[model samples]
Target: MPATDLVTAELTLTGRITTASNATFLGSIGDVAVVYKPIAGESPLWDFPRGTLALREVAAYQVSQVFGWNVVPHTWLRDGPFGEGMVQLWQEQDPAQSAVNLVATDHVPEVGWKHVLEGQDESGQMVALIHEDTPALRRMAVFDVVVNNADRKGDHILAMTDGHRHGVDHGLTFHRDHKLRSVLWGWLGDALTVEELEGIDRVSEGLNGGLGRDLAELLSAEEIGSLAVRCDRLRLSERFPAPSGEMSAVPWPLF
Candidate 1:
């Protein structure tokens, strides 16, 4: 869909975010928290791969809006300390909380709050993951599958204090093929709930209305067609389908 027309002024860099993979800077345009990443002018990390990463991130955010999930608010692409880049409205999450702490063999009563965990690896590299699930979230998992999201890490889920879940970091989504790799496997063999089917139906119906035309500008025809196919399958099955090929199962260490 066409992005919401939110006017964002040029943000000024206030400090450095030492924990991020790229050269992230903390900034603000008015009262909004902005994260800035400049294009690499020198040697760069292989994982980021430069060039189209910024565009991909923007596209992902737009797609997330279609799923009706709370996402890190995307404003616009702009010139930054490095070069052309993206600026997102910063989401305030508990810095000390993580999903790992929430999961246990003993079930915790579903309080409907999901926590986003941001931490460093053994070598002190920053990483994030999501760690909360409810009946509502299970529906989101099915939405991720329809989008062919290749990265749905635990850190991507953000837990707000008021018991709402926000997902982030969707740059690696909308593949034309089945590339879904996530850590949400609790419902591996469970039947798809009726609510889940309804959610998918809403998205599919929205596609033909406005969403399809908008996505056509950013995604290939094949990719959009694949998304429709996924929706149809879910609607027909009325439950989670068994893994058909190697790609259907969740990927390990989903980050």
Candidate 2:
């Protein structure tokens, strides 16, 4: 099936995302900003472990929903012109704004990192990153730790004009073993706030419901169980735990 048949709107390819492991396109579904990945003729650079990218992206979106953060909109998996691929609601970010540029001069206010990467969704339409110091981002950091996100680079963060920080490029996540790597180290040793703790509780509780069912299809039983185990360890430790074992603390830079 073509992308149009699986998706609701007509897709117009704006450009290609050459930076990704797979061939991705920046397109619009009607008026929505969307990222399109085609499975056919995928780049050979993606030689990581099996089920690595898709599983990680899906898990990240699901966990973001549980934590109530504004993650990139994940539409559905469908058959596209290239092959089986995933479609995501596109995020519009100002070309001039970046977390890297800002981090040099000022600190990201408590929980306000999400709002810094806002931009126009489509038609050059602008949206502001909603800025508020809350426990939500803290919780997200914890989730990243548990899942072992190895690519939380600064550029992956899109800061909206309104101040909402949008996280992108979650393809490197949810390793069965510890593989967490990121640049959000400001809260490494900070204790989990009450709200943050509650969010983790919510994810733990969600595993038995829709979240569990969904993960069962994409991840192995051992992987799913490991996710729960990480949460438990985080809860018990009450702070960012030190890295253990022989795995590298970061991913090899593809660039």
Candidate 3:
């Protein structure tokens, strides 16, 4: 069956993801499982305009595809039982692994991990936020920067059983202003690898092609321009960026 046909088929909602800030439902199209977020169900944000979240979610997927990072799952906009919404192919994450963790300060790994920050836990024990220093996560961090992702919570990173990582809940992306609040700040100030640079180059070159065209449909002209500027800036800097701006560097309730 064609891709469109698969998505257009009756989506039977199996359960609701109540933990999601927005209305999110788990459903299946025939045998294919998916996550659905209807445009009508999105709560209006003071910063982000209303009804555009679903489009932004789809646009994030498009950017991931252009960079060939496979960081985001297959996402698209379609009519569902609730209304028009964003639907993404559901990925089962490994139960035992998480991309980000709060380890006891002394338990922090000496190598192969980037320590983000140190803080006191609920029991008054000192803990540190750390993420694995791997190429897959680095790619996701880079993608988040380019998209101006504002709410990259720790739970948003999915660790697959095959060792691949996926980022989700990208509705808070692509703002014209710099609103990159994320927990993946482990690579700050590190130089971009040759392969990472090549990925940026690919995105830069493709902006005026299919990627640009697809984004134009979802974002305003100025937003698209801003995205292009971010790509060019990252390519020129050739390094992972440090947190800036007067706003908080990371999202609240870090989990």
Candidate 4:
């Protein structure tokens, strides 16, 4: 079925995703499952504009597509039961595979995984946080930087059964300020791969065309301009950036 039909068709709410900070619901249009976040349900944040969270989620998806990364799932803005909202096709994450994890400090993996940070656990014993070092995840990290993602919790990275990594919960993104808080900091200071640079180039070129046109509908002029600035900076540096703000680099709760 066409994506338009699926998004506009009558939706049957199956359940609420209570864990989400903003009100979110699981629904279906015919046989297709989707996650929906209504604009009216968004909680106000000091930094972001009111009622714009749902639009930001859809904007993130558009940026992901512009880069040709497909890091974010298919998402769009539409009217739902609660009013205007963001609707995204639900992706089933792999139950057996965990891409991010906490482990005893002594058992940190020597390869394949990147140890992000070390700290004390509840009992005061040393523990470490680690995440898989893969191209899929690297792409997502790059995507987050371009979008200025503010809440990239570990649980937000969905590891699919086929090994694809999908990033979600991008309601806090594309701010004029640099607000990139994330769990994918394993690539800090690393040189961007050729593929990654190419992706950045694609987005930079589109900022004045299709991508910019789409984003203007959801973001402010300053926000769209800041996004282009981020792409340019990343392209020029050709490396992952280190955190530079007074705010914490990683999100709270981790997952």
Write candidate 3's Cα lDDT for 40-137 as tens digits: 89998999999999999999999999889899999999999999999999999999988899999999999999999999988999999999998999
Off by over 4 Å in 4: none
Tell me how candidate 4 scores on lDDT: 0.93
Q: In candidate 1, how many Å is residue 251 off?
A: 4.9
Off by over 4 Å in 2: 1-10, 41-48, 101-137, 246-248, 251-255
Query: Residue 93, candidate 4: how far off, in angstroms?
Result: 0.5
lDDT of each prediction vs. the true structure? 0.62, 0.64, 0.93, 0.93
- Model 1, range 75-172, lDDT digits (tens) per residue? 45677667777667777877665543433323443564343334565666665433456754575577677776667776676666665656665556
RMSD of 3: 0.9
Instruction: Name the lDDT value of residue 3 in candidate 4.
Output: 75
What is the C-alpha local distance difference test score of candidate 2?
A: 0.64
TM-score of 4: 0.98
Q: For all candidates, what are the clash counts?
A: 5, 22, 0, 0
- Per-model TM-score, in order, reads 0.72, 0.76, 0.98, 0.98
Specify the poorest-scoring 10-residue window by lDDT in model 1: 1-10
